[model samples]
Target: MSQTIAVLDFGSQYTQVIARRIRECNIYSRIFPYSVTAAELRKANVSGIILSGGPSSVLTKGSPRPDKKIFQLGVPVLGICYGLQLMGKLLGGDVAKSDRREYGRGRLTIKKKGRLLKGLPKSIKVWNSHGDKVTALPEGFEPIAGTENSDYAVIEDATRNFYGLQFHPEVVHSERGDDIIKNFLVGVCKCKQDWKMSNYVDQAIQDIRDQVGDSRVILGLSGGVDSSVAAALIHRAIGDQLTCVFVDNGLLRLRERDRVEQVFRDHFHVDLRVAKSGKRFLKALKGVTDPERKRKIIGKIFVDVFEDTVKKIGDVDFLAQGTLYPDVIESVAIDGNPAALIKSHHNVGGLPKRMKLKLLEPFRELFKDEVRALGKELGLPDEMIWRHPFPGPGLGVRVMGEIKKSYLDTLREADAILLEEMKRTGYYSKVWQAFCVFLPVQTVGVMGDERTYDYVIALRVVESVDAMTADWAHIPHDILQIISNRIINEVKGVNRVVLDISSKPPSTIEWE
Candidate 1:
């Protein structure tokens, strides 16, 4: 069925931000490629269309463009930044490179009011990241708003229900962004608030069945929300054909082993294999301290372990992954924009050339929150579904220096205590990520009137919507005191405890 709003992505970093803002207005929104047709959007029952901004210029050779048929669908269409330029250029308007590009917050003044901009501030801050601007308005379109840098900042044609903006209102930094989106969703398009997470389950199951008909599949069960939910959906589709391999890299949290076996092996009853390769992984990572090298080593080991397991189960046709949109954006190029590579997430799987298993990742189009909602629809336990984000490298990347069994043990216990205290003080769910980092440096401390030196453990916690940006979470003093005291007294080979007050810009959550 059609949605209340359909956003066609042209590889913008803020594409997800647009979908999120619409949801904040209590309306349903889904994203599709710029190649999506008006027929597809109509089949989805879309009431409105949004063109997301991208890094590419409309004048660039072979840049992405929306389907020509979308414009003729006669729905209320809103365009942003590059989106605005694309619409105007395609519909008999002139577009060119601006001599002075607007790249940050600027003032937007209303030249005329429309239903979309109604009840909005006459002047408000808006974010801009575009080098190209519409030089001439499209036929039948008139200017509705403008900034100092661009004359036709916002244009609209009420007769055709077309609107365009030179700035992004989806960004949180944009003033009155929420109200602007509300006016578009509720006042302009009149979308009904009728999307439920649970409504997606049955459709997903049917799609899975159609894709994996009688074919054997191997799933990499990471115990994270994405993989677990993907496994559940595939299990429902192919039944006994799915085999999940769980490798214990010795970098996992306290009792992580028990939890994996209990949940997947015992409860879900999917074919689960637990490869106890902790000793081998530790030995391989003994002298590696560079963060990039550590991630590469772990990723290689994971593939090797998984490849070996797949050989044991002969003739698997597909390798199922839980790849998300964030993962893809960081790892690979899309829409001709070669993104800088981020961490080598172990979940990003490419089997050896010798192993010929096709990739099957159903969650590739979704973000983390959408995956969590799917987890809920699959009837996953709250604790398993809502667990704080864990890195694929486990504690291997958490430790500051070279990996060691001793360091792994100490870090695990300290992190467990941190988790416990967080839950006790009701901070576990409040913070995005809270964990212990084993600093390589040691400080002198007095114990029982004797001076001693041992490794220091730092507690780092932060809150963020997406892990891209974050701020230091201000933990309560009492809870901090209790956590610090317990770690020092209980965890051995540790003398002092410290708190990390640095945010993401200055410091990442991990020590390594």
Candidate 2:
């Protein structure tokens, strides 16, 4: 097993973020449900323990809680938000629904010096999202930190190696959150900061080898980073035992199908099977103008094709996927709190129920950037690592109204021109994601004496940490003008160009 820090998840949306932050500090961490027993955790060789925040109040019945034996494990424990409340309740402390609730940004003032707050300022900003607060400290525990609203903001039992924080230090808003976590891991837990992408690659390959001993695994290669990285990791483990299926759904970017096939079969030397099912995908998608319907149809059809290919290959016992962290996080509502359902990722949402093969998701815990790091470690080209995020439905979603080859071709050319100019101007690497949407509406424009009614194209670029939220990238007007002029002149059927100013909450990264 990999050297790991186990996070007992209480269904907090930010649980994964906490794990990601620990990994960012060069420590390997995995998340388990709060119901996980001490024996199960011990079997995983947990070097440290973290109790993640949850949506439910600790006072509520049936709310998740960790096993009592966790405290007696002689391992370091850190709790955040609801995890802190649960710790307080279990350790003979008082927890109550705060009359004055604290959410968003708050100040955490360190009242007493402790290892968890060492190397930090006397007071620091922290991100908070809790309705309840610890009213009283547990026996043998002292309050190390507090905010104006929360007296028991942070509590610790140095003798027991347990630390609890009322606010979230995992998020970016918590200025010194990472520093606090680092201090706890090194100073208190004595955990070595040895985790890295290279280490992960080595360990993942070994894990895959051990799990699939002589069993064949077939993976669907979507040419996106997730599937590509997953396929590469499996290939590194089992070599010829792994067969990659790259299905051409006809909705990919211009010439992406060929590029994907060549990259895997020729460039990477991975065993690859290319199935051109563009006609079938388009056929299932014919006359589907509704965005959600288009996505569902495409998802269903892709699964059908992939499952058929797996059966044809025969002897496949495992189905591998490039399912990433955000894909998992957005699917389920954390802590029983309602979270907006973002677009259903094809690989994640399109899985066939009761498949004959078991599932293998190596990148399930990795964020997008971390996946890119693993890709680089696996020797994938820089172009693949830096490629823009593409929706699983592909150009089917880029075109707003109907599915047609002509519309897809036009959008493809315009998008290519936009990307080419961004790369040429050295701005491609600066922007997190940049793409073009083919608007269904057409506008009249005059060229010399002739009037033409054609499609309008909208360009979007955003800067974001996770695709969960984003800000519109501020490209210079001169750059935008160049892209707009080039698209209108070079790409036929597009007469007007517009820039998307909305951010993620109001508008998703993709137009659909």
Candidate 3:
């Protein structure tokens, strides 16, 4: 509610990570485009400014650049990666293409004791991802730190509180990254450590009421934490004005439709409607095999069905979705940059044709954990709030390659067995995602000296603080053995089970 830091997004994938880190320190932060001017930032009462790293070169034509007047805003400015090069170019410092690009984890040695790096060690490892380096500094600037190949890795102007780092200090892979952000946020900007997820409830409720006014809102509740929490918030703000539509596409996990409907319709007193269109969805996806094609088909189909449902609901003013911050950052490219496509958001990219109703997404700025915290603040059950996330396409993406009713049936059964065993072994809550992917292939197996050939199921389980990055969960060997045995023996179609041991960078949590 008070003064918040402004993080300028120049098409960086890790821009949200920087904002998340600042919030972790109990300091409020918001993200903006690189085109935001100093007048706009000042109007928002920004206490400090952070320039996020981007996949761009300062020398490239049409690359994103911040307003020139930002340096004169009388606030602390920290530049990272491409942000450093941009500052070096505009402030009369020299930057050049490095013969050897520095990437991944590296070390930074302090060259001078500056206020930004005040309490840090003489040398610390940091994450670097840049092809260009600052060769010289501007007037009144001093070199603060350096890595082996990077001579001017860190530069600072103590007088005006301007600092730049060639490495990304917002990532967890960077050693002492949190300390660096804390020093800049608290030490330099004088921000109060008062931001809390619980405090967002009242503010968000007031905002929703002001925005929605007397208009009717329709939300597509997928029973996921983000959507359920978002629906609860909007319902609280406008009691009888919000109607929910839960669509069962015949691709969800076991008993998902019944449980979600009971929770929202019966318990929360929400005006909920169920659309029985599983047969249509399955027929549309009968022969589709490509991943992106499958997603587009689902997106287009969902919008069509959702629009039809809204037509029956009569006179709706807005379409509400439970979209989180990650969905926002990944779906749309920041300033139209390439390599920004992680995946397409169903609600965002799924839109078809022109519509009269406005779109509303209250949870677009919050992360997954923050949404859960808000759900708790709204008195949601612990089991519902702590459930693992499900994708928009449901089991369509999980069933690799072709789409078939038999494949869906096998995947659903194996997935249920996997979940049951994980819950029994007490590892369900410890893992971020646990599911079964239908590998459309067969393997030969021995069952009491008899040869058996059937479909193979790959189980994916990972541990992560957030879904942005994750590592394969290391469950106890005995528990895993039990899971594999149950999934293979109990599930009729699945004759073999394999566990995915890859991390986030190399392999995404979902097999597709």
Candidate 4:
């Protein structure tokens, strides 16, 4: 087995982020409950252990902590934020509530360039989000770096191969954050960078084969990257044992169904079944203005279509989905550690239990980029692999408020035009996600020689390393003008186009 870096979750929201950072360094990392015993860590042969930051303070009576025996395991250990305070308290140091809580950027002044702070700069900025600080070091520990508010910003026990950081280096806001993590993972832990996408691909195939010996697997194929990639990988593994059911809910992007058919059916020669249920979905969504209701209607229609399709194809043993790690991480409530559930996702939504089929999520532990890499290894086309994320409700959410066939048709055309212009100007790949929204209210405008009233289109484009947070993309005025002009002239929709310049916290990427 390959050596692993075990990140013990203390309910920090960035726990998954830390795991991703480790994976980006070509090192395998897995998140475990904070209560994971030392024997379990030894059994897994972890090269290093990372204690994630949490909301609770170590001074609290019922705060989470790891096994005391972990210190004796002899592997390199790094604690972050709340983890740092816990480390101090457990190791015979003083940890108290800070007079001034450091919740944002702080300048780190390096006192000693230790292995954890193994760089040339004397000062660097780091993101700090902590309410408590380590006031005094343990017997064998020394302060390697400090910020203005906290004297022990970075502490290390060189004799024990243990380190702690008051700031969060897992986040992108911290300068040279990746380098800091690399130092701990590579230098201190001595982890060989053997983790790669190719290795995952080979292992996933064998695991799939082993799990699904003679069982038939049915996957609900959404043309989006995740499901498409999942379908491709499952097909590559089981060959004729997989059947992909593509449901056309009449709310997808322009030519999305055709693209799925061409890629999975024509190119890969997999068993593809296309369910043309556009009318069913549009009928069910008629006059539904509430976003939640629209989602419910779409989801119900999808399940109906999927069940009907699967019934005709006969019984399948397993239902496969392209559930990535982000989805799983969002819903992880690890042992009362106060990790919030960012969102709830059931890729197929209770279908496995209702239909009595085993759930097969091969990419459940993999991230989005990793899935794309896996897709590439499975020989999927670039367009499919690099496609932006699409909401489960599809264009249903893009057409804000009311659900009408005319609205969907207009939205699809406008969105297609927007994407075409984005790709033409080489802006599609530059931005994380770019799509157009169809406003429910119509605006009056003069077209050619006549006055007309039509719907308005809103363009939403953002730049982000992860969809957790996003900033509006500053596409050049020329490209925006081109996209706006094309939507108005080519698509039989609104004459007016507007840009959304709001960031993620204040506004979401999708209008609905």
* Number of the top lDDT candidate: 3
Q: Output the TM-score of candidate 4.
A: 0.89
Candidate 3 has what TM-score? 0.96
Better of 2 and 3 by TM-score: 3
Q: What is the TM-score of each candidate against the true structure?
A: 0.89, 0.93, 0.96, 0.89
Clashing pairs in 3: none
Off by over 4 Å in 4: 35-37, 56-69, 89-94, 136-139, 210-214, 283-315, 328-338, 343-352
Evaluate all candidate structures by whole-model CA lDDT and list the values in order: 0.83, 0.85, 0.86, 0.85
Would you give me the overall lDDT of model 3?
A: 0.86
Better by lDDT, candidate 4 or 3: 3
> Which candidate number maximizes TM-score?
3
Which ranges in model 1 have alpha carbons more than 4 Å from their true place? 23-28, 35-47, 67-69, 96-100, 185-190, 334-342, 349-353, 505-512
Error of 2 at 127 (Å): 0.9
Model 3: per-residue Cα lDDT over 1-512, one tens digit each: 66789999887888888998998998778888888989999998899999989988998888888999999999999998988888888999888899899989889999786667878889999999999988888888888889987988888888988889899999888989899889888888889999987767887898798888999999888898888888889999998999999989888888889898889977789999999898989999888888888887887777778789988999988889887777766675634443367777676643544656677888766778888888999999898899898998899999999889899898898899888888887899988889999998998887778888989999899998767888999988998888889888888867898889999887777776
Clashes of 3: 0
Error (Å) of candidate 2 at residue 199 is 1.5
Residue-wise C-alpha lDDT for candidate 1, range 1-512, written one tens digit per residue: 45568989888867777987886665677778888878888788889999999888889898888888898997889998988999999999999999999999999999787987888878989998889989888889999899988988889988988889899999877888787777778777888767666555665677677887888999888797778888998898789999998888898899888888888977799999888899878888989889888988988888788788888888788889888776666554554443345555666646667777877888766677777888888888888778777777889888998988898899999999999999988899998889998988889998788888988998989898766567889998989999988998899988889988888656665665
Candidate 2 Cα errors over 4 Å, as ranges: 1-3, 333-340, 505-507
The 10-residue segment of model 1 with minimum total lDDT is 332-341
How do the residues 147-200 of candidate 4 rate in per-residue lDDT, one tens digit apiece? 999989999999899999999999988998899999999999999988987877
